[model samples]
Target: MEEEIRVEFTKNGFDFDEEEVILKKCLSFCINYKLSASDIVSSWDVYSLNRGLELTVRSSHMGAFLEQLQNEQLNKVREKESGLHLYSNDVAMILDGEYEEVKEDMLDTPTSKPASANKQPSDSTGKISGSKFSSGKPQESVTPFGQRKSKFAVQSSLNENHIKQIVKVEDHTNSEDDIIKRVRPNQKCTMRIMSSQPKPGCRFMYDRIDDKFNFLENRIKKQAISYVSAGICDEPSDPSIASQKSIFAVGMICCEEEGRLKEKPVLLQSSVEHSGGQRVRLDFQKLNQFSVFPGQVVGVEGLNPSGHCLIASKIIDYVPLSVDSSDDHPSKRQAMDQNLQMTNLSLDVPELSLIVAAGPFTTSDNLFFEPLNELLAYARRKQPQLLVLLGPFIDSDHPELKKGYMNCTFDELFQLEILGKLRDYVEYMGSAVHVILIPSIRDANHDFIFPQPAFDIHPADFNHQIHSTPNPGTFCANEVKVACCNVDILKHLSAEEIFRNPQGGSKHRMTNLAKHVINQCSFYPLYPPAEDVPLDYSLAHEALHILSVPDILILPSDLAQFVKVLSLEARNEGERQIKCICVNPGRLARGEGGGFFAEINYKGNPDSSSASIIRI
Candidate 1:
C-alpha cells in the first residue's frame, strides 16, 4: 500500500524523500476524511493531473499540505468559473456559487433532494454558505436581552394533525429489555448524607463564625502536615524565616484584609504561629507558574530578605496521592472483604438505570418550565428506576425571581412549580419510580449556603418514592455508590488555576477538573470558592470531605456537560483500586431552549457501566 501511494505520487509529479513520514501523514488524512487508501490515490491523481497542479506532500506538515491541496482545487474551479458545465452537483454548485438557490430548491422539495445534497462541501466558502442557510431558517429576531422567541410562534393555531406530526413519539428502543426499568417501591436503595447539613439556627452567630474560621485554619494545617509526612514538603515554617535566598515555607494563602478583591496582593499566613503568625505578602512576579486562591494551603520556595514580601520562586499547591506497598496487608484485606459481605445486600441487584439532570429548569423567557415538562415526559417514557434531579429549583438569578414579579413568595413558587411537578411525576409513574432531589446554592427557596440541607417535604404518601438529600450528598443505588454536588467547581477552578506546563496533553479540561476533586478528596476543593458560592466553614470538616472514593461523582456545573469514567489509583497498595464515573449534567435550560441531561446504566462493575449526555 505504501509503495502504491508513493508510486502514484511520483507519477503525478510529486516526490518526497521521507517515505515513512509521508505514509503516516497520508494515513492520518485518510482516517480523518474517512477515505480508503485507494480513494486517496484516485483523488490525488485527478487533482494532480486533470487540475494541472503539481501536488507536494510535506511529511512534517500535514495541515499545510492539505491546505495547499484544497487551495489548488479551489483555484482550478475559479479558473473555470466563466464556463457553465454539467459537472457533479458539488462541483457545479462550487462553479456557479448559487447556494441560496440550491437551499431554496431543496427546502421546497425535501423528499426529492438527493442524498448528495446533504453532504456538506469541505471548502471554507461552502461552510460559510451552509451556516448562512441554517441561520436563514424561520427564526424570530432575538430580544434586547438575548432571549429568543419560541420557535413555535403559531403553536396555538396549529391543528391536531400538525401537533401530532410535530410531537411524534419515535420508538427509540431496539428491544424491550433496552427500555429503562422501573423502580419498585420496596426496591432496596440506601441514601446517606456524607456532608454535614447545617440544622436551622446552626450558623451566622459569632460563635459559628469563630468555628468556621477555626475550621479553615485547622483544615489547612492538617493538609500541610500531610504534605510534610508524604515528603512532598517540609514542616510548616514562619513566613518571617524567608530570606534573601530562596527558602521553602508552608502556609495558607489569604488576602491581607477580609472582602479584599482577588486582584489585591495575597498574604501567606503560616500554619504554625511564630512571631504571632506573621503574614508576608506574596510576590508571584518571579514565579513561572502557580495557582493560589485565597484559603488554599500551599508550599512556596521563595525569599523575603526584608521580611516584607516573599518573592516566590516556585509554588506547590497540591500533595501527591499516598501509596503503600501491596505485600504488607493480606490479613487486613480479608477482614475488609468480610465487612463488605455484611453491606453487600443492597448491591445484589443485577442492574440499575438512572436519569440525572441539573437545573434552572425554567427557561429565561418565562417561568413556564417547558423544558422540565419535556424532561419529565421523557423520564416517564423511559421509566428509569431512579430520577436524580439537582437544583436551582427556584433559580435566584432568574429574571422573574430577581424582579420579585411573582404573585407568590419564593417558597410558594418552589412548592407549586418544582415540587408540584415532581409529585405528579412520581404518582403518574407509579410507586415503581423513585426520585431524589438535591438543592443548589442558587435556589431562591433554599438556604443560600454550602452544605445545604434537603428540602423539608412532609407528604405522607410521597415519602416512599420521593427522597431529598443535601446539596453535597451521597447515596447507593443497587451496588453503585454515588456522590454529587451542584456547585460549579469547574468554572471556579478554570478561573483560578495557573498551570506551569503549557504543553499539557490534549486531555479534556473536564477530566482534569474531575481528577482534581478526587485527588483533593473534597466536594468543593477550590478554596475561596467562586464569589456566588457561600461557604460556611463551621460545617466544613463534615460537609466537604469525600470519605471514600465514590463509584459515581456528579459535579453539575455551568460548563459544557460531559460523562467521563475516571480511574483513580489506590493510595494504599493493598486498597482496592477505585474507578469512578463522573457526570456533569448541564443546566436543564439554556436561555429559552433546552440543554442536556445524563442517563446512566450501571451493573456491578464500573468498567461495564454506560452513560450518555443526551440533549433534551
Candidate 2:
C-alpha cells in the first residue's frame, strides 16, 4: 500500500527526491481512514481542487491539504450522524453550478437530527461494497428541466436475457433462404468508416443552422414528392397559410415551449420556401393514434380551419421505400437460383464477429475503470473481428467530475487511462483485430456538439487497427454497415414524444423512437434537440443525414438493453424493404454495478446474423 501511494504521488508529479514526507502523510491518511491508495490519491485531488491550486509538489504545503481532507472526513461523520439526504432539489443545485449558493444555504441552516435514529450507518460506496470515488457523480439518468419522463411500463424482455445469450440474429422474413457462404479470415480489413461532417475543434456558424433546417425541409419535401407520384400522398401545401379544406402538408414536428409534446402545443414548422419556416399548431385530436416528436418531417393530411392550427386527419411519419423489382419477377429469380446450383460455384464470404460496448466504462463508485478493464479482458478473450466502443469514456456527469474533484486534464486522463490499455490490447491482439472509438457530446476531452467530431488522437496513436468516428457516424464491418450514435436518444425521445394507441408496449415504443431516427434520416430527429445535446443545426444537414440505412444501428441509452430487428413498411424500386438490427449495448457500467455489451455474429444478411445482450 505504501508503494502504491508512492507511485500515485509520482504520477501526480511528486518525486521521491524530496517528496518522502508527502508519501508518508498519504500512507498515514490511508491507514487512519481505511481508504485505498486510489482513494488517497483522489483525496489529494479533491484537496487541491477545493484550494484552487495545482497539487503542490513541495511537502511544505502538505499539512494544510491533509488538514482540509481531515476536516472533510469529520464533516462526513457529521453528515452520517445527521442522516442528511440529498433530494432531487439538492442534485439540481449542483447541476446548476451554484455550489457556493448551496454552501451558503447549508451554513445558514442547522444540521437536523436523523429522521430515523434506528437507521444504521450507510456503506461508504453509498450502497455498493468495495467501491471508491470517481471524479464526480454525474447524473446519467437525470433529464434536464422541462424534459420530464412519464412512467410507462415496458413489456419485459431485455431483463429475461440478462447474463444469458440471446443466441441468434434471425431473419423472420417469409422469403426463401439465401445461399450460404463459408466464413474465412480476411487478408486485409475491408471495414470502411465515414465521419466527414465535422472536424475536431472546427467552428460552425449559428446562422447556418437556420439554412440547414431550411435545406432539410426541402430535402424531406423532395422525398415526399416520390410518394405523391405513387399516389400514396397528395401534393403538399403550406400548413403555415390558412387552408380550411383537407390538404396534405409537410413540415418538421416541434414543441412550442422547451418541453415535451403534449396534444395542444404541437407545432409544424414548414420549409422556408413554402411557409418561410413558419410554425402552425397541430391538432391531433382528430387522428385516432400517432406518435410525434421534434424534428420529425411528416406529410400530414389535415384541415386548417382557424388558420392558427392544422387539424390532422392522417399523418405520414416517413416516406416509403420499395423493394427491388426482382420480387415482381419471381420466375427469373428462380431460374437464377437454379443456374447457381448447376454451375457448382462458390462465393466465399467473410463472416464477422463483433463486440460492442457503450460508455461510462467505469462503475459509478470508483475511477478504477474495473468495468473497462474487464471489457478489454473479454474482448481479448473473444478476439472478435471488430470491437465498437462508444464514449463519454470520462463521463462529464459523474459526481466527482461535477463537483470538480479531478486532478488532471480530461485529455491526459484519456490518454493515460483509456488509450494506454487500448494500445496494449491492439499490440497484443495484432492487426487482425479492429477497434472503433466513437465520441459522445458528454466526453469531456472531445469537442462538444451533436454530429460530434471524432476525438483527435496523437499521430503515434493513429494505427490502422483503431479508428475514430464522429458521434452518430457510420461504418462497414465486412458487408455489414453500422450506424452508431452515443447519445441516449431513446431516453430523450421518450421524455419528449407523445403517442397514443401505440400498438406494441414500451419495448416496441422504444423501437419506434429508433424508427424515428431512420425515418427522418437524421441521427437525432428530436427537434429542439434534447437540452443536453448541443446540436449545431449548421452541421446537422450533413452530420445528421443517413445516406443509406445501415445493417446495424447502435443507439445506446439508459433504457433497457436489447437487440431488435426492425423492417421498413415502404419499398423502393432499387432497394428492397429495408431491415436492420438495432442494438443498445446499455452502458458498460450502470451506476456502481456492471451493465451490458452486445456480441454479434453476422454472415452477410439479417437471416444469418445473431446478437445478444450480456452482463459485463
Candidate 3:
C-alpha cells in the first residue's frame, strides 16, 4: 500500500512563532541529557517536520532562550527532517568579549554624546582608529541587537599590555535568513533570567595581593552578545578588573566575612580545609600548632585534589597571628625535685589488680633511668588491665663483686632498691594485683657446696642432692604460683647425677616445691593431653601458666618473645590453638607498651588462613 505524503500542520509554511516555541522546548530537553545548548548549534529544513517532536531547554533562562529552544527541539526536528543533526560550539568567549566592548563604547561617550558621535575616524569605514578603551584603532564588535563596532577597539582592549584581558565567544549564522527561519529577523525577543546577582548564600574569600573580592555576580546577560562591549565595564568602571583575572574556583562555599571571630582561623582556598579527607568543615580542635585558618588570604603550599576534596599541606597567611599561649608562659608547668622517692607506682585502672616482680633489671645505680615510682604512679592513674613481673632476682656472683665476703643474699643485697621500685610499680598497678615469683639460678646459688636436692629443680645446685625428685616451690605473701628454675642459666652446667631425687629437711621447702609442681601442671592448657611434658621443664610452659592465671598479662619484649615462641610451638605440635602478639621494646621499657588482648567468636566454618602481623 502506498502511504500518502502527510504534513501534520505546516501553517501554510514555516510559522516562526511555533518553530521558536518548539526549539525552546527542545533546548530544555537537552539539559536533562547532560548536554549544553550554548555549546552546540541546531539546523533543520522546514520540509521535514511532520510528526510532532519534543525539545527541552538546558536552562530555563531567556538569555539562552533562542539557543536553548533550538537545542531542545533539534533532535525531533532532525527526526522529522530525516535524522539530520545540528552542531553547536561554545561561543561564550567570542560573544562575551565583543558585547563588553560595545557596552564600554556606549558608556565612554557620556550621556550627552551618542556612541556614534565618539566613533573613531576609521569606524564609519569599518577601519576604526583607537578610542578611550581600545588601541585608538577600530575593532569589530557585535551585539544580539545587531549593534556593530570597529575591530580596532576590540584589539586594543585585548592588547598584550592589558593586565586583565577579557575573553569572548561569538555565534555566527551561515546567513541572516537562517536566523529568520525560526523567528523574525528584526523582532526583539524577551529574555528569561535564570539567576541575577548570584544567590544570597554565595560567599567568597578575598585575595590580598589582588585586593579584590571574589564575587559571584551575573555579568553575562546574552549568549550571542559580542566581545566589543568592552567600553561598558572597562578597567575604570570596574576598578578591580585590572587586578583580577577570573572567578574563584567553583569548590569554595560562602561563609561569614573575615576577622569576625577571634578564634576562627582563616584558611587559604588551596589549603586542606578538611581533615580525614571528609567534606565536613575543618574544626579548630583538629588544627595543630601550624594550622591555618579560614578567611585568611593565603597562597598555596601543598595541595592534593584526588580524593573527596582538596588537601593542602602548606598555606601562607599574609597577616600571621600568635595563638599559642604556652609560648608566652613556659614556667607555668611545675618542676619536681630530683631526689623525690618513687615509692608509689599506682596505675588508674580501678577494675583490675597488678602484680609485677622485679629482677636484676632493678638496681640502685640505674634508679634514675628506671624511675619505677614515676612510671607506676602514672600507670596507677591509667588503671591498666593488669601488670605482672615473674620474679626479682639479682646476680650475686659477678666476678668483680665482693658480696661473697659479706655473705649477703642476692635479694638482701638489692632489697632496698628492688623493694623501693617494686612498691612504686605496685602502687601504680593499684590494689588489684596477683604477683607470682620464679627464683632465678643466680639468686639461689650456694657456692656449689650445698647438695643439690633430688627434687630441688633449682639448676644452680649441680653437685648437691639428686634422685630425679621434684621439689616443692616458694610463693609470695599473696599465695600466687611461685617456681624457681635455672632453665636458662643451669643449661650451661652438668648437674645430671645431683638433679635426681635427694633428701630435703624442712617441710616448708618441700611444701613450696610441691606447690610449684602442682600449680605448673594445673595452669598449663592440657590440649592433646600432657603425655610426657615435664612439670617444671619449659620456660614457655611457665609463661603460659602465668598467662592462664589472669585476664591480662604484662611482660617485657624478651619475655613476650618467649611467649610468642611457645604459642608457635603449641600450634606446630598440633596441641592447641594459640594467638601471639609482638610489640616494640621501647614502649615496654617506658612502661607504656603492653599487648591488649581480646577474644573473637567465629560462627561460620573456618578457612585455612595464615596468621598476619601488623605494626602500629
| TM-score against native, each model | 0.61, 0.65, 0.21
Top TM-score prediction, candidate number: 2
Kindly state the number of residue pairs that clash in model 3. Answer: 123
lDDT of 2 by residue, 33-103 (tens): 78876567656544543233433455776788678678778866754664432221011223324544543
What ranking emerges by lDDT with the best candidate at the front?
2, 1, 3
Point out the worst 10-residue segment of candidate 2 by lDDT.
121-130
The Cα local distance difference test for each model comes to: 0.63, 0.66, 0.24
Model 2 Cα RMSD, Å? 20.4
Model 2 gets an lDDT of 0.66
Between prediction 1 and prediction 3, the one with superior TM-score is 1
lDDT of 3 by residue, 1-616 (tens): 0000011112111123344555554455445444333222211211111111112122233344445345556644544654322111112222436645654564474657545345333221121223312222212122111121221121111012211211111023323354343342221211111112111222222223222211111011110011112121221111111222321111112123432121232222221222211121222232232312122222222323332222333322211111111112323312211111121123321122222323333222111213233334433432333333332234332211221211223333334434444554544333443223333323322111111122222223221211121111222222112222222211111000011111131111222222222222222222111222222221221132221221122232112111111121231232333222211111112121121111111111011111111110
Clashes of each: 2, 21, 123
Per-residue accuracy of model 1 over 511-589 as CA lDDT, tens digit each: 6657777766678876667776777776666767766677789998766677777776654456566677888887778
Question: Model 2 shows how many backbone clashes?
Answer: 21
Clashes of 1: 2
Error of 1 at 104 (Å): 51
